[model samples]
Each structure stands twice: as C-alpha cells, then as structure tokens.
Target: EFFYENIQGGDFSQTKSFPGLSEHSSNFTLYYETDVWGARLSTVYRSDYITDGDGVSSDADEIGFHATTNVDFSAFYQVNENLKVTLEGINLTNVAEEQYNDSADRIYNVTTSGRTFYLGASYKF
Candidate 1:
C-alpha cells in the first residue's frame, strides 16, 4: 500500500502560507506473505518545505526542512498456530534530520539517530 499527499500551501493575509506546509509527502510499502512467513519493507518521504511564511522579506520563521527519507523493514515467521518470531529494523539508513534558514543556507540545526533493530517471539494460548 502507498499513501500520498499533495496539499496547497496556506494563504496568510500578507504571505503565501505558513511553514512546514509541504506540497508532497508519501509513504510506500512492499509486502509478501505465505502460510508461515511474512515480510514488509517501507519508506517515508517528504519534500523540502518552509517552516514559517509569516514574513519572507529578510528571513522566515523556523526556516525550511530539506527533503528527507526513512526506510524500515520487518519480517515474521510462524512457528505454530499460536507461536511466532519477529525481527525488525528501523531507520535502516540513519537518515539525519536537517533544517535550514529561510534562505536555504547556513544550517539551523541537524540531528541524527542511529539505526535500531528488534528481535522477539510471541505465543498465545
């Protein structure tokens, strides 16, 4: 399944719109399953967007975020009717979070999060 969004920017009295209003954003997923096994891979993406449109004269508020993408994956194997094992990986690529000033120059702030993984089992009576 794939989810997509394309929205018009807001129109303030004196400006085009507010910040963080992206024209395009999407999430795509791929999956496969069998009687005893299942797996899925997905990605989330967002286009560059302004953070504040109150004033575009000299500078804007919050600024704009650069285009970003994140990937994740998961899989599971059924051991029995009520038992299963699962594995998952999040932010597989460790995409960083970045924001720039209105001018699209000079970094405002950049954050990073390492990839994560999980392994577990479940049972039901």
Candidate 2:
C-alpha cells in the first residue's frame, strides 16, 4: 500500500498550481529460465486519481491501469567447449498506451505510451 500526489504548473489566475492528483499502484513479477530459454512476467494495477480542488485540474483525476510481460527465447551452442552464442528478445508482449488520465471531469481518460519490441545477440569466448 502506497500513495502519491501531484500539482500542475501554469497560470491559474491567482497562482500557478495544477490540480492535485494522487495514484496508487501495485505490481509483482515472476521469472523462469533454463539452459535453453528464459522468460519473465509482470503486471501493474494503478488506482484512480482524485482531484483536490475544483477548477484546478487541467485533466480531472480518473481511474488508470497498466500491465506488461516479457519473454526471452535463446539457444546456446558450444564450439570446442570454449565458445557459445545466445539470442534474446526483450519485451515480447510490447504493451502500449497503458496510462489513463481524466481531462477535467470527463467520462473518458487519456492513455500514454505503446508496446515496443527489441532483439539482440551475444557471444562468449
């Protein structure tokens, strides 16, 4: 259990304070791997944000949620028992647009980011 608070920035007539918003997020991760391959899984849930004062928030506080999972598929081979090679793929699920925002007491929330994938190879001697 945790908490967070934020204030906007800009000219709001008398003062430059954005709406104060708070969010709570919880997450967990699990990992599994073998000589041939390995993988990791994780997820995060964020609670809705509430506005502190009226007419102060650029975007009204709203409920938000996000999650992500990654897996790496690798193959290893030994050359003369001295050299080896491995291949990996990061962020297999490629989750995108996970964040949500409430824009001034609206019914819908805004989302941010998108899924991404990456690959690489390595050699050991």
Give the candidate number with the greatest TM-score.
1
Kindly report which residue stretches of model 1 are placed more than 4 angstroms away from their true locations once superposed: 1-17, 55-62
User: Residue 25 CA error for candidate 2 (Å)?
Assistant: 2.1
* Clash list (residue pairs), candidate 2: 8-18, 59-104, 60-104, 94-115, 96-114, 96-115, 97-113
Pairs clashing in candidate 1? 19-51, 19-52, 20-50
> TM-score, each model?
0.76, 0.41
Q: Encode model 2's per-residue lDDT on 9-100: one tens digit a residue.
A: 43432222223333455766666666555566665544444433333346543333333333334334343344445444444445443443
Residue 5 CA displacement from its true place in model 2, Å: 15
True-vs-predicted CA distance for residue 49, candidate 2, Å: 2.9
lDDT, residue 48, candidate 2: 47
lDDT of each: 0.76, 0.42
Q: Model 2: how far is 100 from its true place, Å?
A: 7.7
Q: Which numbered prediction scores highest in lDDT against the true structure?
A: 1
